[model samples]
Target: MDNMVSTCPICHQPTSPEWYFCPNCGKELKAKLIKIPLITQIGIYALSIFLPPLGLWPGIKYLGQKSQEAKMVGIVAITLTIVSSVVTIWLTFHYLQSYLAIYNGLLTNPSGLSSF
Candidate 1:
Protein backbone atom coordinates (compact mmCIF):
# COMPACT_ATOMS: atom_id res chain seq x y z
CA MET A 1 0.00 0.00 0.00
CA ASP A 2 1.86 3.04 -1.23
CA ASN A 3 0.56 6.55 -0.72
CA MET A 4 0.13 7.83 -4.25
CA VAL A 5 -0.74 11.42 -5.07
CA SER A 6 -3.85 12.12 -7.08
CA THR A 7 -3.68 14.55 -10.01
CA CYS A 8 -6.47 17.02 -10.58
CA PRO A 9 -8.38 16.51 -13.79
CA ILE A 10 -8.73 20.24 -14.38
CA CYS A 11 -5.12 21.29 -13.91
CA HIS A 12 -3.28 17.94 -14.16
CA GLN A 13 -1.39 18.98 -11.05
CA PRO A 14 -0.49 16.62 -8.16
CA THR A 15 -3.00 16.98 -5.38
CA SER A 16 -3.23 15.77 -1.82
CA PRO A 17 -6.44 14.20 -0.51
CA GLU A 18 -6.80 17.31 1.65
CA TRP A 19 -6.91 19.36 -1.52
CA TYR A 20 -10.64 19.72 -1.99
CA PHE A 21 -10.43 21.62 -5.28
CA CYS A 22 -7.32 21.94 -7.44
CA PRO A 23 -5.19 24.78 -6.06
CA ASN A 24 -3.83 25.52 -9.53
CA CYS A 25 -7.08 25.87 -11.46
CA GLY A 26 -9.36 26.06 -8.41
CA LYS A 27 -11.56 23.38 -9.97
CA GLU A 28 -13.25 20.75 -7.87
CA LEU A 29 -11.59 17.45 -8.81
CA LYS A 30 -12.02 15.52 -5.54
CA ALA A 31 -15.58 16.73 -5.20
CA LYS A 32 -17.96 13.82 -5.64
CA LEU A 33 -21.13 15.25 -7.14
CA ILE A 34 -23.59 13.14 -5.23
CA LYS A 35 -26.85 14.95 -4.64
CA ILE A 36 -28.57 14.38 -1.30
CA PRO A 37 -32.35 14.63 -1.32
CA LEU A 38 -33.03 18.24 -0.39
CA ILE A 39 -35.76 17.65 2.23
CA THR A 40 -33.91 14.96 4.18
CA GLN A 41 -30.57 16.79 4.08
CA ILE A 42 -32.33 19.99 5.11
CA GLY A 43 -33.89 18.31 8.15
CA ILE A 44 -30.60 16.77 9.30
CA TYR A 45 -28.65 19.94 8.59
CA ALA A 46 -31.27 21.90 10.51
CA LEU A 47 -30.93 19.56 13.48
CA SER A 48 -27.12 19.79 13.35
CA ILE A 49 -27.12 23.56 13.17
CA PHE A 50 -29.92 24.29 15.65
CA LEU A 51 -29.07 21.32 17.85
CA PRO A 52 -25.73 20.35 19.40
CA PRO A 53 -25.97 16.61 18.59
CA LEU A 54 -25.13 17.42 14.96
CA GLY A 55 -21.60 16.96 16.24
CA LEU A 56 -20.40 13.87 18.27
CA TRP A 57 -22.09 14.90 21.54
CA PRO A 58 -24.72 12.18 21.34
CA GLY A 59 -22.24 9.29 20.84
CA ILE A 60 -20.28 10.16 23.99
CA LYS A 61 -23.46 10.89 25.97
CA TYR A 62 -24.86 7.56 24.67
CA LEU A 63 -21.98 5.72 26.34
CA GLY A 64 -23.69 6.26 29.70
CA GLN A 65 -27.29 5.93 28.55
CA LYS A 66 -28.79 6.25 25.10
CA SER A 67 -31.84 7.85 26.66
CA GLN A 68 -29.62 10.46 28.30
CA GLU A 69 -28.23 11.31 24.91
CA ALA A 70 -31.81 12.03 24.00
CA LYS A 71 -32.09 14.00 27.24
CA MET A 72 -29.01 15.98 26.26
CA VAL A 73 -30.65 16.78 22.94
CA GLY A 74 -33.85 17.64 24.76
CA ILE A 75 -31.86 19.85 27.11
CA VAL A 76 -30.52 21.78 24.15
CA ALA A 77 -34.02 22.07 22.77
CA ILE A 78 -35.43 23.23 26.10
CA THR A 79 -32.68 25.81 26.40
CA LEU A 80 -33.60 27.25 23.03
CA THR A 81 -37.27 27.23 23.90
CA ILE A 82 -36.71 29.15 27.12
CA VAL A 83 -35.40 32.68 27.70
CA SER A 84 -31.58 32.41 27.69
CA SER A 85 -30.10 32.96 31.13
CA VAL A 86 -28.94 30.87 34.10
CA VAL A 87 -32.69 30.37 34.42
CA THR A 88 -32.65 28.52 31.10
CA ILE A 89 -30.56 25.85 32.79
CA TRP A 90 -33.21 25.59 35.49
CA LEU A 91 -35.80 25.03 32.76
CA THR A 92 -33.62 22.32 31.23
CA PHE A 93 -33.16 20.62 34.58
CA HIS A 94 -36.89 20.79 35.19
CA TYR A 95 -37.63 19.45 31.72
CA LEU A 96 -35.19 16.56 31.91
CA GLN A 97 -35.13 15.56 35.59
CA SER A 98 -38.76 16.53 36.16
CA TYR A 99 -40.01 15.93 39.71
CA LEU A 100 -37.48 13.14 40.26
CA ALA A 101 -35.09 15.32 42.23
CA ILE A 102 -37.40 16.88 44.77
CA TYR A 103 -36.21 20.39 45.59
CA ASN A 104 -37.97 20.82 48.95
CA GLY A 105 -35.80 18.30 50.83
CA LEU A 106 -32.67 18.87 48.75
CA LEU A 107 -32.79 22.64 49.08
CA THR A 108 -32.03 22.32 52.79
CA ASN A 109 -29.44 19.63 52.26
CA PRO A 110 -27.87 20.63 48.93
CA SER A 111 -26.25 17.27 48.06
CA GLY A 112 -29.31 15.44 49.46
CA LEU A 113 -26.82 12.76 50.54
CA SER A 114 -27.48 13.54 54.19
CA SER A 115 -30.43 11.14 54.01
CA PHE A 116 -27.98 8.25 53.57
Candidate 2:
Protein backbone atom coordinates (compact mmCIF):
# COMPACT_ATOMS: atom_id res chain seq x y z
CA MET A 1 0.00 0.00 0.00
CA ASP A 2 3.03 2.28 0.25
CA ASN A 3 3.09 2.53 -3.54
CA MET A 4 -0.55 3.66 -3.66
CA VAL A 5 -1.38 7.37 -3.74
CA SER A 6 -4.65 8.71 -2.42
CA THR A 7 -6.46 11.44 -4.34
CA CYS A 8 -7.96 14.66 -3.09
CA PRO A 9 -11.76 14.59 -3.10
CA ILE A 10 -12.11 18.24 -4.09
CA CYS A 11 -9.53 18.59 -6.84
CA HIS A 12 -8.99 14.92 -7.81
CA GLN A 13 -5.22 15.41 -7.41
CA PRO A 14 -2.89 12.63 -6.25
CA THR A 15 -1.78 13.12 -2.67
CA SER A 16 0.10 11.25 0.03
CA PRO A 17 -1.61 10.15 3.19
CA GLU A 18 1.23 11.71 5.22
CA TRP A 19 0.56 15.08 3.62
CA TYR A 20 -1.91 17.39 5.35
CA PHE A 21 -2.86 19.18 2.13
CA CYS A 22 -2.88 18.49 -1.59
CA PRO A 23 0.16 20.00 -3.32
CA ASN A 24 -1.67 20.51 -6.59
CA CYS A 25 -4.89 22.19 -5.32
CA GLY A 26 -4.08 23.19 -1.72
CA LYS A 27 -7.08 21.19 -0.44
CA GLU A 28 -6.82 19.57 2.95
CA LEU A 29 -5.81 15.94 2.47
CA LYS A 30 -5.71 14.55 5.98
CA ALA A 31 -7.91 15.02 8.97
CA LYS A 32 -6.05 14.55 12.24
CA LEU A 33 -7.52 14.18 15.71
CA ILE A 34 -6.07 14.06 19.24
CA LYS A 35 -7.29 10.81 20.70
CA ILE A 36 -7.36 10.09 24.43
CA PRO A 37 -7.34 6.48 25.58
CA LEU A 38 -10.20 4.97 27.60
CA ILE A 39 -7.88 4.14 30.48
CA THR A 40 -6.74 7.73 30.73
CA GLN A 41 -10.34 8.88 30.73
CA ILE A 42 -11.10 6.57 33.65
CA GLY A 43 -8.05 7.88 35.50
CA ILE A 44 -9.18 11.44 34.99
CA TYR A 45 -12.64 10.60 36.27
CA ALA A 46 -11.19 8.96 39.38
CA LEU A 47 -9.10 12.03 40.04
CA SER A 48 -12.17 14.20 39.56
CA ILE A 49 -13.97 12.30 42.28
CA PHE A 50 -11.27 12.02 44.94
CA LEU A 51 -9.04 14.93 43.90
CA PRO A 52 -11.03 17.47 41.93
CA PRO A 53 -8.31 20.07 41.43
CA LEU A 54 -6.04 17.55 39.78
CA GLY A 55 -8.83 16.42 37.50
CA LEU A 56 -9.68 19.94 36.30
CA TRP A 57 -6.50 20.32 34.28
CA PRO A 58 -7.21 17.41 31.93
CA GLY A 59 -10.88 18.37 31.78
CA ILE A 60 -10.18 21.88 30.52
CA LYS A 61 -7.41 20.64 28.29
CA TYR A 62 -9.63 18.08 26.61
CA LEU A 63 -12.47 20.54 26.29
CA GLY A 64 -10.17 22.76 24.25
CA GLN A 65 -9.39 19.94 21.87
CA LYS A 66 -11.19 19.58 18.48
CA SER A 67 -12.34 15.99 19.01
CA GLN A 68 -15.94 15.17 19.99
CA GLU A 69 -14.97 12.23 22.21
CA ALA A 70 -12.38 14.29 23.98
CA LYS A 71 -15.00 16.94 24.62
CA MET A 72 -17.30 14.34 26.14
CA VAL A 73 -14.57 13.10 28.42
CA GLY A 74 -13.77 16.66 29.35
CA ILE A 75 -17.40 17.38 30.16
CA VAL A 76 -17.62 14.28 32.34
CA ALA A 77 -14.42 15.20 34.15
CA ILE A 78 -15.57 18.75 34.82
CA THR A 79 -18.99 17.59 35.91
CA LEU A 80 -17.47 15.17 38.37
CA THR A 81 -15.18 17.86 39.67
CA ILE A 82 -18.08 20.25 40.26
CA VAL A 83 -20.24 17.63 41.92
CA SER A 84 -17.47 16.40 44.18
CA SER A 85 -16.45 19.92 45.12
CA VAL A 86 -19.99 20.87 46.01
CA VAL A 87 -20.41 17.80 48.19
CA THR A 88 -17.11 18.43 49.92
CA ILE A 89 -18.00 22.04 50.67
CA TRP A 90 -21.41 21.13 51.97
CA LEU A 91 -20.00 18.46 54.26
CA THR A 92 -17.37 20.81 55.61
CA PHE A 93 -19.95 23.45 56.45
CA HIS A 94 -22.27 20.93 58.02
CA TYR A 95 -19.53 19.57 60.28
CA LEU A 96 -18.40 23.05 61.20
CA GLN A 97 -21.94 23.97 62.20
CA SER A 98 -22.22 20.86 64.33
CA TYR A 99 -18.91 21.63 66.05
CA LEU A 100 -19.97 25.20 66.69
CA ALA A 101 -23.20 24.09 68.27
CA ILE A 102 -21.31 21.71 70.56
CA TYR A 103 -18.87 24.42 71.55
CA ASN A 104 -21.71 26.90 72.30
CA GLY A 105 -23.45 24.33 74.48
CA LEU A 106 -20.26 23.75 76.45
CA LEU A 107 -19.77 27.51 76.88
CA THR A 108 -23.31 28.14 78.14
CA ASN A 109 -23.41 25.18 80.58
CA PRO A 110 -20.70 26.09 83.09
CA SER A 111 -22.53 24.20 85.90
CA GLY A 112 -22.05 20.85 84.15
CA LEU A 113 -18.27 21.16 84.07
CA SER A 114 -16.18 18.88 86.29
CA SER A 115 -12.60 19.58 87.27
CA PHE A 116 -10.22 17.84 84.88
Candidate 3:
Protein backbone atom coordinates (compact mmCIF):
# COMPACT_ATOMS: atom_id res chain seq x y z
CA MET A 1 0.00 0.00 0.00
CA ASP A 2 2.47 2.60 1.20
CA ASN A 3 5.47 1.26 -0.72
CA MET A 4 3.32 0.39 -3.76
CA VAL A 5 3.82 2.63 -6.79
CA SER A 6 1.25 3.25 -9.54
CA THR A 7 -2.47 2.42 -9.51
CA CYS A 8 -4.04 -0.24 -11.68
CA PRO A 9 -5.83 1.29 -14.66
CA ILE A 10 -9.08 -0.55 -13.92
CA CYS A 11 -9.22 -1.14 -10.18
CA HIS A 12 -7.14 1.94 -9.41
CA GLN A 13 -5.51 0.00 -6.60
CA PRO A 14 -1.75 0.20 -6.03
CA THR A 15 0.23 -1.53 -8.79
CA SER A 16 2.97 -4.02 -8.04
CA PRO A 17 6.58 -3.59 -9.20
CA GLU A 18 7.11 -3.87 -13.00
CA TRP A 19 3.77 -5.62 -13.54
CA TYR A 20 2.93 -5.74 -17.27
CA PHE A 21 -0.88 -5.60 -17.38
CA CYS A 22 -3.00 -4.08 -14.68
CA PRO A 23 -4.19 -7.00 -12.55
CA ASN A 24 -7.54 -5.31 -12.03
CA CYS A 25 -8.34 -3.95 -15.52
CA GLY A 26 -6.06 -6.18 -17.59
CA LYS A 27 -4.55 -3.06 -19.13
CA GLU A 28 -1.03 -3.33 -20.42
CA LEU A 29 1.23 -1.30 -18.13
CA LYS A 30 4.57 -2.33 -19.63
CA ALA A 31 6.04 -3.23 -22.97
CA LYS A 32 6.50 -6.90 -23.82
CA LEU A 33 10.06 -8.21 -23.91
CA ILE A 34 10.80 -11.08 -26.28
CA LYS A 35 13.61 -13.40 -25.41
CA ILE A 36 15.65 -15.82 -27.59
CA PRO A 37 17.55 -18.82 -26.31
CA LEU A 38 21.35 -18.66 -26.41
CA ILE A 39 21.44 -22.15 -27.87
CA THR A 40 19.27 -20.97 -30.73
CA GLN A 41 21.60 -18.06 -31.34
CA ILE A 42 24.68 -20.30 -31.39
CA GLY A 43 22.90 -22.87 -33.51
CA ILE A 44 21.95 -20.26 -36.07
CA TYR A 45 25.54 -19.10 -36.13
CA ALA A 46 26.70 -22.65 -36.81
CA LEU A 47 23.98 -23.04 -39.39
CA SER A 48 25.42 -20.02 -41.15
CA ILE A 49 28.66 -21.93 -41.50
CA PHE A 50 27.02 -25.01 -43.05
CA LEU A 51 23.73 -24.63 -44.92
CA PRO A 52 21.24 -21.80 -44.61
CA PRO A 53 18.38 -24.22 -44.98
CA LEU A 54 19.70 -26.03 -41.95
CA GLY A 55 19.28 -22.78 -40.04
CA LEU A 56 15.67 -22.39 -41.15
CA TRP A 57 14.55 -23.91 -37.86
CA PRO A 58 16.16 -21.30 -35.63
CA GLY A 59 15.52 -18.56 -38.18
CA ILE A 60 11.80 -19.27 -38.08
CA LYS A 61 11.85 -19.07 -34.31
CA TYR A 62 13.36 -15.59 -34.35
CA LEU A 63 11.45 -14.45 -37.40
CA GLY A 64 9.60 -11.11 -37.21
CA GLN A 65 10.99 -10.53 -33.75
CA LYS A 66 11.41 -7.18 -32.02
CA SER A 67 15.16 -7.50 -32.52
CA GLN A 68 15.80 -6.83 -36.18
CA GLU A 69 19.51 -7.37 -35.64
CA ALA A 70 18.99 -10.98 -34.68
CA LYS A 71 16.86 -11.59 -37.75
CA MET A 72 19.54 -10.11 -39.95
CA VAL A 73 22.15 -12.24 -38.28
CA GLY A 74 20.15 -15.37 -38.91
CA ILE A 75 19.51 -14.46 -42.52
CA VAL A 76 23.12 -13.66 -43.27
CA ALA A 77 24.38 -16.72 -41.45
CA ILE A 78 22.04 -19.03 -43.31
CA THR A 79 22.94 -17.53 -46.66
CA LEU A 80 26.66 -18.02 -46.05
CA THR A 81 26.14 -21.61 -44.98
CA ILE A 82 24.18 -22.48 -48.08
CA VAL A 83 26.64 -20.74 -50.38
CA SER A 84 29.59 -22.46 -48.73
CA SER A 85 27.96 -25.84 -49.02
CA VAL A 86 27.26 -25.32 -52.70
CA VAL A 87 30.80 -24.16 -53.38
CA THR A 88 32.24 -27.13 -51.51
CA ILE A 89 30.03 -29.55 -53.42
CA TRP A 90 30.98 -27.97 -56.74
CA LEU A 91 34.69 -28.35 -55.94
CA THR A 92 34.26 -31.93 -54.84
CA PHE A 93 32.45 -32.83 -58.07
CA HIS A 94 35.02 -30.99 -60.16
CA TYR A 95 37.70 -33.20 -58.63
CA LEU A 96 35.51 -36.29 -58.79
CA GLN A 97 37.02 -39.74 -58.20
CA SER A 98 40.59 -38.65 -58.92
CA TYR A 99 41.09 -37.21 -55.44
CA LEU A 100 38.98 -39.95 -53.88
CA ALA A 101 41.15 -42.64 -55.40
CA ILE A 102 44.33 -40.82 -54.37
CA TYR A 103 43.09 -40.12 -50.87
CA ASN A 104 41.95 -43.73 -50.47
CA GLY A 105 45.19 -45.10 -51.92
CA LEU A 106 44.51 -48.55 -53.53
CA LEU A 107 47.39 -50.97 -54.18
CA THR A 108 46.50 -51.18 -57.91
CA ASN A 109 47.37 -47.55 -58.55
CA PRO A 110 49.94 -45.31 -56.88
CA SER A 111 47.10 -43.42 -55.13
CA GLY A 112 44.30 -46.02 -55.57
CA LEU A 113 42.26 -46.60 -52.44
CA SER A 114 40.53 -49.87 -53.46
CA SER A 115 42.12 -51.68 -50.49
CA PHE A 116 41.02 -48.88 -48.20
Best by TM-score: 2
RMSD of each: 13.4, 9.6, 10.4
Provide the lDDT at 53 for model 1. Answer: 40
Candidate 2 is scored at a TM of: 0.64
Off by over 4 Å in 2: 1-35, 114-116
Off by over 4 Å in 1: 1-3, 33-116
Question: How many clashing residue pairs appear in each of the predictions shown?
Answer: 0, 0, 6
Span of ten consecutive residues with least summed lDDT in model 2: 28-37
* Candidate 1 local lDDT, 55-80, one digit each (tens): 23432343334342344444544443
| TM-score, cand. 1 | 0.26
Report lDDT per candidate: 0.52, 0.85, 0.66
Model 3 C-alpha lDDT per residue in residues 20-85, reported as the tens digit of each score: 678777887654455447776677777766654676666655655555445666566656667777
Specify the poorest-scoring 10-residue window by lDDT in model 3: 106-115
lDDT of 2 at 73: 93
The best candidate in terms of lDDT = 2
Give residue 64's lDDT in candidate 1 (0 to 100). Answer: 39
Pairs that clash in candidate 3:
48-77, 104-113, 105-112, 105-113, 106-112, 106-113
C-alpha TM-scores of all predictions: 0.26, 0.64, 0.42
- lDDT by residue (1-116, candidate 2, tens digit) is 64367889898887776677788889865454666787999999999999989999999998988765788899999999999999999999999999999999888876646665
Q: Lowest-scoring 10 consecutive residues by lDDT in candidate 1? A: 55-64
